[model samples]
Target: MPKVTFVQMDGAEHAVKVAAGTTVLEAAKANDLPMVGTCGGSMVCATCHVKICAADRARLPPPTEDEEDTLDLAFGVTADSRLGCQIELTDALEGIRIQLTSTM
Candidate 1:
């Protein structure tokens, strides 16, 4: 299992443990976190936008070109921005932390 921490824009945080191979959006949804996956984990929507926190940003795999394109439509795009639906959980991401922007 891997633990993911989601920090809301208001500074509230929710941590959830999920199985490997889960998407960040799925984990968030399963735990009732505020992330909104409007496209249901498809790469087509930017509603699942989240910022990879500085501490865990480097641990994630680089985003694909499509993901980058979708992110461009997301509000509050930042250097660390990522669409949660596109991020799959892995053993290496055990303690990943993400910050929810005000976009949603």
Candidate 2:
């Protein structure tokens, strides 16, 4: 399993362990974190937007074109922004940090 930490707007940290290959959005949902996957991880919506921590961003591959387009619809998008559903967990991603963002 890989551990992921979700940082809240208030700087609260919620750490959860998930199986490798589980998407970030799925990890959040399974742990009861406040994340929305309106399109059910189908890559059709940006409700699962999250920001990868600057230092950990290198652990992930670049977002796909479709993911980039959908992420444009999320509020507070940043240079490190990514749709949670598009990020699959891996042993290499253990201890990754992701910041929650608004669905709108």
Q: Which stretches of model 1 miss by more than 4 angstroms?
A: none
After the best TM-score superposition of candidate 2, give how far the Cα of residue 104 lies from its true spot, in angstroms: 3.8
Q: Model 1, range 1-104, lDDT digits (tens) per residue?
A: 98878898899988888999999888888888787788897878799998996668788888999999999989989898999998899989987888877655
lDDT score at residue 77, model 1, on the 0-100 scale: 91
TM-score for candidate 2: 0.95
TM-score of each: 0.92, 0.95
Off by over 4 Å in 2: none
The clash number for model 1 is 0
* Candidate 1 Cα deviation (angstroms), residue 79: 0.2
Q: 1-104, model 2: which lDDT tens digit per residue?
A: 99889998789999888999999989999988889898999988789999987789887998899998998788888998999999999999999999998675
lDDT of each: 0.86, 0.89
